[model samples]
Target: MARVKRMERVVALTKQLVDHPYQLFSFTYFCKKFEVAKSTLSEDVLAVRAGLEAYDLGRVETLAGAAGGVRFIPCHSEKANEEFLTELALQLAEPERILSGGMIYMTDLLFKPQLVMRLGEIIAQRLRHLEPEYIMTVETRGIPLAVFVARAFNIPVVMARRVGQITEGSTVSINYVSGSSKQIQTMALPKRALPSSARVLVIDDFMKAGGTARGMAELAEEVGAKVVGKAFFIATQEPEKKMIDDYTALFVLKDIDTENRKIDISPL
Candidate 1:
């Protein structure tokens, strides 16, 4: 095989690191793959790290010593996060998005792959310090967000079902009151989906009273797992109180005037 040029090696290294966020790769492994000296690979890695830092794309972290390796950590700048959330809040505040019941129609926005991918990155970056072992969410709209966050951490996503499926085998079920409707709702998860003592990060699309988010945390406790953090795409400010207290949300929904066809929302 021909020896790869410095520029070509640096680009390839960047691609590999970005494609597998949070995954550690040893210097020896890359040195062998590119048929280059350890010194050459070190310089290439420095170049990749500098480029990533310059653009605020993410981070390239290197560990030293015998059990050392390099990995990519997905991150977003505060300014970038603020700008994106501001634009998203504006888009969501459009009068046409308001429903008859004072609810904002956001299905279209939640399902967009590109948009949700960015949302996931923002959430993941903020919560990455918690070092959650798995991303947990209920079935449906929250799945995409959970998957993308899990991708950023190189972890698995575990989903609870609204109704237990036979395919899941034996499962644990729990009933909790809806924060908004005040009605009892049941959610279940497979016994084997999560292991004991695992750290869980609960994520969801929206929160009104945080009933669903609370239910997920309770379910995690039932499985002997700890709820390290909770995150949401949007949370309402009306209730003033929620079932869960510690949570991060990208946007706050302050009010929806059905009569006037107006929605009041802002980035948090």
Candidate 2:
């Protein structure tokens, strides 16, 4: 291959790092791919990192030594994160989004690949320090969010199902009260899905009474997985007391006025 120019190399490198976030690539691999010297590749990586930081897109971290390389971490600057969340809150506050049961219809938003990926990036940035081995979530709407977060971390996603499957083989099941309906519900996971003492980051699309998240935490415990953190896309304020104690949420649904069809939401 012909030698790649500095600008072209920088652009290509940025795309490669962003596409494979949190995965390390050796310097030798890049040197060969671009037909450039180690010094030239170093300059190229630095330039890409600088551009990403300036734009608040994310960050590129370099590791030294023979086993070292570059890794991309998906995180925005503090100011950028706040601004983006604020805009998202406004979009979610539209009255049309309010449903009859004090719930905001958000399935459409969660299903959008780009939007969910961005939300996942923000959550991954917040919880990356936990060094979770696996991203876990209950089956359904939260699956997309969890998958994107797993992608951001370069890890795998483990899902707990409401109904047990024969294909999953022997499973561990737990019964918990539904936060909203106050009805008993069972959630299960494959016995071999996670190893003992695996660190888990629990994610969900929404949090109301927190029963669902709490149940997931309990399920993780049964499998000997430590629950490092719990995160939600949106959490409601109606149930001030939640089943789970510690958790983070991107947006707060302050009020859903069914009578007036008005919705109030804010970034946390």
Clashing pairs in 1: none
TM-score of 1: 0.97
Question: How many times do residue backbones clash in model 1?
Answer: 0
Cα displacement (Å) at residue 265, model 2: 1.1
lDDT string for model 1 (41-104, tens) is 8888999999999998999999998889899988878998899989999999999998876688
The CA lDDT of each predicted structure is: 0.92, 0.91
- On lDDT, the candidate that comes out on top is 1
